[model samples]
Target chain A: MNNYSTFGTALHRLAILCYVLFALFPLFWLLKVSVTPNDLLYSEGVRMWPSRMSFEHFRFVLAHSAFPVFFRNSMIVAGATAVIVTLLASLSGYALSRFTFRGKYWLVALMLLTQMFPLVMLVAPIFKMLSPLGLTNSLTGLVVVYTAFNIPFATFLMQSFFDGIPKELEEAAKIDGATQFMAFRQIVLPLTLPGIAATLGFVFTAAWSELLFALMLISGNSAATFPVGLLTFVSKFSVDFGQMMAAGVLALIPACLFFLFIQRYLVQGLTAGAVKG
Target chain B: MVFDATAGFPESRRRSLVDRITRHAEPYLYTAPALILIVTIMLAPLVLGLSYAFRDVHLLNPFSGGYVGLDHFRTLYDDDNFYRALRNTLWWTGASVLLQFVFGLILALLLDRPFAGRAIAQALVFLPWAVPTFLTGLNWAWLFNPVIGPLPHWLYALGLMNEPANILSNPQLAMWGPIIANVWWGIPFFAITLLAALQAIPRDLYEAAAIDGAGAFRRFTSITLPFLAPTIAITVLLRTVWISNFADLIIVMTSGGPADRTQIVASYIFTQAFRALDFGYASAIALVLLVLLLAYSMLIVMLRQVLMDRA
Candidate 1:
């Protein structure tokens, strides 16, 4: 029995190691190519690591290319979307959690329908709608679209988090002469900070990663998000693998940071949602 | 109480009516912004998009907004690429979902065991899910590039290929490239959800099973599988719909290239709208996909209901 348990432990550890390696390998490769000197890139082809590493690609991408502008644009759009979505989602989520009202069923159903159908379907119509408003080719346009796109999921997430908290906290405040909104603002919102953080991170990463809409809406490099810019860069400078990889690495940072922060709560939140449903 | 001189109602009745109105309006007030945005931004566009299917709406052609009933659908029916895209959608969604689910279940099972450094392991393994889909596509595309990436070289070394070649450009093998990238990116989602489900299963059930001389496999089959069934069903169903509509990786990595071998319906719709700039045809394709997905979802729900009844 002792030998058998030892064998099991070894197998388990080996399996875990494989998964970790598989998960990290592509990222590792991305980083590897990013740091490899242009001189050695072709000569040392398929190497796990180059003979010498350099930050020349990163420097070039940051300084010479339009990537910095793209990065800033992405940050602005994602940040704005995250803030707007979280704020709207919190209020609506609070309503969903605390109140039973008319149109509630339809509201939830409408959101679910949005998730089911393809957002690609809306691309042309939205372009038509926003074009007349002069919203195309603008970061503000991207933010607006992303905020709307992310609100349903974020609201569902926030609602799940709100559901986890006791209703008594708000109810007690309400009894103590606080309006329902006041109770929510002063009592409930403060308590769901973790949920708020998770929602922010989730929305930020989502907005940051959005591609098709960003591609369709924004026309030029000045307003291009990271994904669109990188794509165009790939097409324009197909030879600069090192620089493109460097840009890819830069794009990975904020998203990975946010993801690392929120991933711990992800399972807990989902379990809460599953149980609530 | 002050008297209401302006209206026929008394002061107390007016105050009560005001309170009632406020109480009734509170939830709507809270939800109104999100509702309005959803209507204008999402719902309205969705309705317009549906209408676009029956109209002649080209992005570049300003004069092409005339009603052309069934013209786009008729064109879609005749388009061989659309048919090919439909077939490819089935293959892509099926392979990606199946592979992701299997590997995800295994990963979740492995992580469920108490092991040293599990926290860091969990974080590292789940990191891929964080990589932006476009970056994931680019990263994988580069990895398959024979000149820079090691994958082709490794495959060649293993006698799996004739030469180190970029699989993304090979029509027969291009679909696999996106599918593989998809599996890598999607596995963590399934793992996370399944892991949550696994944790929710009663530990005492395993203990009881073991106490009754049930082996590990037996306990897993009797306890874990049964406990995970509902979660698996729901996640798989939702993921199927989501993945079918997901065109990011394919768009980025291959762009449905090499004679459109990787052109699933979603990507096909995107190609029509973005590349071809034919909004009408794109909407028509999208409508078909939406109907198909709804049918799939309805079928799954009914199947689950029938299974529940039988049980």
Candidate 2:
């Protein structure tokens, strides 16, 4: 029995190690190629690590290429979308948590319907709609679209967080002459800081990673998001694997940071939601 | 005191009426901004997109946008690529979901066991879900490139290939590239959800079962599977719909390449609209996909209802 248990433990650990390596290997490769010197890239074929590394790719991508602009544009759009979506989602989520009102059911159903359909269907029509208003090729346009796209999911996320808080806190404030909105803003909002952060991070990552809409809406390098810019660069300069990987590495940074920040809350938040759901 | 209270009651009654009106409008007030945005941005475009399927709308053609009922759908019916794409969608969604669910379940079960450094292990294993989809596509594509990537060489050494050639260019093997990338990216979603569900299964059940001389496998089969069934059902259903629509990996890696072998319906629609500039045809394809997804969802919901009723 002791030997059997020891064997089981070893198997479990080995399984875990395999999963970790599989998860990290591609990312490891991305980093490795990005830092490898151009002179050694072809010569060091299939190496786990280059004999020597340099910052040349990163420097070229930063100074000579249009990646910095794309990065800045992505940061602005994602930041704005995160802020806007979180704010709207918080209010609506609070309402969903606290109130039983007309249209609440329909509102949720509509949001779920949005999730079920292909957003690609909206690509052409949205372009037509925005083109007339001169919203195409603009970061503001991307932010608006991303905010709308993210609101439904973020609202549900925020609602789950709000549901975890006791209703009595807001009810107590309400009885003490606070309006419902006032109670929400002053009492409830501050309590759900973790949820707010998670939603912000979630929306930020999503907006940062969005590809198709960014590709369709933005025409030029000046307004392109990271994904679109990288893709365009991939096609335009197919030879510069090192430079492209460096850009790819840069794109991974903010998302990984946000993921690390919110992953704990992500599981916790979902568990609460799932149990309640 | 009675006279003073009577006088204040009328004033308070009027104030209370105003408060009642405000209370009734409060939720709507809170939801209005989000609702308005959804309507204008998502809902309205969806309706317009449906209409676009019936009209002849071309991006570069000034003479287009005329009503041409059933024209695009008629064309879609005869388009060989559309049928091929439909077939590919099934294979792609099935293979990706199956692998992700299986691996995710295993990982979740593994992580459920408490051990030293479990927290860090959990974080590391779940890290892939954070990589952006486009980057996931690019990273995997690069990994399959024969010149820079080691995969071809490794496969050759293992006698799985004739030589160190890029699989992305091989029609028979190209779909695997995107599917592999997708599986790697998607496993965390299932693991996170399943792990949560696993954790929710009462620990006392396992203890009680063990006390009754039930083995580990027996306890899992009797306790864990049943507890996880509902979560598993819903997550799998939702993920099926989501993954069918996910074309980023395919689009980035192969662009439905070699011979359009990887052209799933979602990517096919994208190609039509983006590359061919045929919005009408794209919307028509999208409409078909939408109906199919709705039917799948409806079927799942009805099945769940039937299962619940039986229970």
Candidate 3:
């Protein structure tokens, strides 16, 4: 029995180590290639680490490229979408959680159906619609579209979080002459901070990652998000490996940081959702 | 805030007609912003897109956007690429979802076991999920490059490839490039969800099973699989639908291919709209994909219902 248990422990650790390597290898390779000197890029090839490294690619990308504009545009779009989606989702989610009104079932069905259908269907029509409003080719348009696209999922996520809280807290606040909205704002919202953070983090990453609509809607480099910008880089300088990987590393930073910060809450939120479902 | 005059008023102090109306209108008020946005930004566009299927809405043609009356669909019926895309979508969605789910389940099971350094391990393993989809596609594309990446070299060394070459340029093996990247990116999602579901399973049942002399495999089958069934069903169902629509990796990695070998319906529609500048044909293809997806979803839901009834 002792020998068997020891074998199990070794196997478990080995399995975990394998997973960690698989997960991190691609990212590590990206970093490795980013810092590799131009002279040794191809010569070093499959070497786990190049003997020499430099930040020349990063410097070039930051100084000479249109990446700064793309980065700023993505930030604006993602940040605004995150804030707006969370706010709207909170209210709508609270409604779904607390009220039993007519059309609630249909509302949920609509949201679920939205998740199923292809968003690509809307790209052409949205471009046409927004073109008339002068909303195409702008950061604001991206924000508006991302928020609407994300609301259904965000609302469902927020609803699950709201569902985790007991009803009595809001009821107690209401008994003390607080309005329902006040009870929600002052009483429940504070307790649901983690859920809110998770929602914001999720929306932020999704908005930042949106490509197809971003591609069609924004043409010029001035308004391009990271994905569109990256594609342009690939198509333009198909051989500039170091600069592209460097840019990719830069793009990875914010999303990964936010993800690490809020992933715990996400798991907790989903656990609640899983149980309820 | 001022518009909602009765918003601040208590029920006892304001039992008047305005208060009653306000009380009844509260939920609608809460949901109104989201509903309006969804109707305009999502549902409205969805309806317009449906109409574009039957209209001539070429982007560059100033004379386009007229009623074409199923002309695009008639063309699509004979389009060999459309048929190829439909077939590829099935292969792509099926392979990606299956591999993601399998690896994810294994990872979840592994993590469910308590161990030293589990926190850091968990974080690292889940990091790939945070990589932007475009970057994921690009990084994987580079990884399969014979010159820069080690994958082709490793495959060659392992007797897998005849020589070091970019798989993205291989017509016969091109689809695998996007599918592999997809599996890598998507496994984290399935892992996270399944891990949550796994943690929610009552551990005392496992203890009880072990106490009854049930082995590990036996306990897993008797408890884990059954408890995981609902989550699996829902996640797999949603994932099937979502992945079928996903085309970023394919578009970035292969642009639907050396010979359209990797062309799935989602990416094919995107190509038509953005590359061909033919919105009418794109919408027509999208309409078909949507109908097919709806049918697929309905079939699965009915199958699940029948399975539940039998159980």
Candidate 4:
């Protein structure tokens, strides 16, 4: 037998098992609900697995509905916002992390102050501001709004990443006759890939799931995102659990795929190789 | 294009111009995009919100409005729903943050041990963090369904609940349903941050404690807990600030329903601006939330100062 306390170790293992199961059970249920035949939803009553499985809802959502358009719209908005914000954040973050400039402290304080206000307060004014410019119902408008909202946090995220990198490498590149921008692009940019990936994934997910602004700005289904589309399952009278959960399950795929694609970089602490201890 | 003019200009003026450009060039180049976007998109709306808050603003009354000078705030203060929303928001921000920190601390400590399959276990624990907030809210809403939910069904099977009760339909339980969901979603962040800090602790500390004959509980108190304190405090602050602004969860789960029972500041503001179309009053309530967040941030700064002094 092992010298370690069997009872304590077993208890620990049991606790971990319980927590993992608890955390994962919802996703399992989502998959389960999505597969359950619509007729058996109420009659079968909380069964872990459905007696019969069907892909009818997914078929209906994909082919016979506007969900595909909504899906495409979400992808466009998320992709554009992520790319734009990351590009903006990387430069600003590098400056914040490396440079000592005039009014640097005040600029940082101003950014922090912007974050303090509730976003809801800004909605009406934002709408008022956007409507006049013919931007209320456009994908570009959504991207603009998301880029604005995500930039501060992304900048901070990128700043921390930049801080993790040593300044000596850039100095070395400068001494070798490269300009600042050249050094940043050639050396620092490659090292900051992990941070950029994380920021892109973060901003993408945020824009994808955002409902409030999308709801407020877009009136028609043309510009409506998946979150707003999910609301269509809710009529005034009765909530359609089958279609809603089905849509919910479908909406998770892009996010899942995005994470799966970027998960490698996300898990790797890339700053480790950028600087020597 | 202006080479001849540059020669005609004073030498000192020319030198200063070059100096200015060189001195300011890099930071200006780097910060230009962010500053332009932030000023136009963020700052303009902020100023516009403040001005809209003071006017008798409505959706139909786009910009042509009369000044109301705290009238909206007064109406807001008198409204019972506002107070309820404030109370519920306070409970949400405070309770969720504290409970999440506690559970995360416990989980992190357990996982910090040398064990097989620890990485897989950590990933599973972090699954909730990756799920979208709306989806998480929907999942919890289903889990608390009265007739056909696993949780209530299991509770009934275990002889815990009287009936397969709709927890979200209940005023007392509905508020907590979202809070519980938030805590579950938020725990992974705290766990990850704390685990990183825990891994940085020197093994010598534990060995020294064992040499002094300190048992597991004693070691936890004397070594682990103290070392983890600063990280715990900072992570808690971050989670609190994030959770206080949480609208997606509340909006999807309840829509502040069952008699405005679960309304928090953020969701309340959403409804006021969107549902009621009362922009002025909504902006006032949002300003209230802004003030609250500012105060909490000040507290975080103070906490950081204290932690630095202790270090």
Per-candidate total of colliding backbone pairs: 0, 0, 0, 0
* Residue pairs in clash, model 2: none
Q: What is the lDDT of residue A157 in candidate 4?
A: 84
Q: Candidate 4, which CAPRI tier? A: medium
* CAPRI quality of model 1: high
lDDT of each: 0.92, 0.93, 0.92, 0.82
Q: Give lDDT: candidate 1, residue A124.
A: 85
State, as a TM-score between 0 and 1, how close model 3 is to the true structure: 0.96
Give lDDT tens digits, candidate 2, residues A163-201. 889999988998999998899989999999988998899
Better of 3 and 4 by DockQ: 3
TM agreement with the true structure for every prediction: 0.97, 0.97, 0.96, 0.92
Which of the two, 2 or 3, has more DockQ?
Answer: 2
lDDT of each residue in A248-273, candidate 4, tens digit only: 88888877777666544433453243
In model 1 chain B, the worst 10-residue window by lDDT is B1-10
Interface RMSD of each: 1.1, 1.0, 1.2, 2.7
Find the candidate with the highest lDDT and give its number: 2
lDDT of 2 at B76: 87
Q: Arrange candidates by DockQ, descending.
A: 1, 2, 3, 4
